[model samples]
Target: MFTIQQIDGAHAKVKTGADFPKYIQEIKELGVTAFDFLVSNGVEVYYGEEPFKTNSPAKYDPLNINENLNAQQFAKELKEHQDGKTDFPYFVKMCAINGIASWKVDLEEYTCTYFDLEGEEVLQEEIPGE
Candidate 1:
């Protein structure tokens, strides 16, 4: 089972069961490049930890950038994933670009926590059963 929680405008946390790795592999089979996955889905993707800079007398925008995609496409992707028609690597990448460290699994607890770019707990909650 799994649960996802939005931490903020561009960050979220996901808690998943022991089957996380398999889950990732399944999504990889979807054959979507990370870039295409994010843009097509309207989720923003970033490369590294540098904030964007604007030279308005030395004002720095957050180097890290976020995506602004079609909301309908995003919603459609979510629905497809829920129906088991798509994989989640795209979402996983989104989380990582936005600042999630790793999608590590805890064997004993059968769960994992996603951290935001600031290393803060964001998503945490398991499905009702399993």
Candidate 2:
């Protein structure tokens, strides 16, 4: 799962040294890999990974960003992962219920949904790291 909360810290750190697009790309890569590891180990995961477009005064070129490709592609690719293999979010939640930290998940795919163990739906406002 991807938490805007946790990512906020990482994002802030990345922004100081990297362009917004590069920072987002790196975060998505790391976040997906972390989720995959947790899934493989049977651990439940929960987080959001939706990508967004913004005008960054911090960037050297305000128009250099492309939201059409990055955010949409990431979301689409992740959905493809869950299409037939296994329910990514469910897999993570199961691990969490058992107190596991990771499970085997298909690294070939990625998504923005999070795993929930308590059977309670998580809202953007409810993420723990925030």
The Cα local distance difference test for each model comes to 0.33, 0.34
The alpha-carbon lDDT assigned to residue 26 of candidate 2 equals 51
TM per candidate comes to 0.33, 0.21
Tens digits of lDDT, candidate 1, 1-130: 1111111111222233233345433322332112111222233331112342111121122333233323344345434544555445555444434444433223334344444434455454332223
Q: For candidate 1, what's the RMSD?
A: 14.9
Instruction: State how far residue 52 of model 2 sits from its true place (Å).
Output: 15
Q: Model 2, range 1-130, lDDT digits (tens) per residue? A: 4454555555565422113334345555655442323333322232334442222122121111121223333334334433434344443333344333222222224222332333222211111111
Q: How many pairs collide in each candidate, listed in order?
A: 9, 19
Candidate 1 lDDT for residue 88: 52
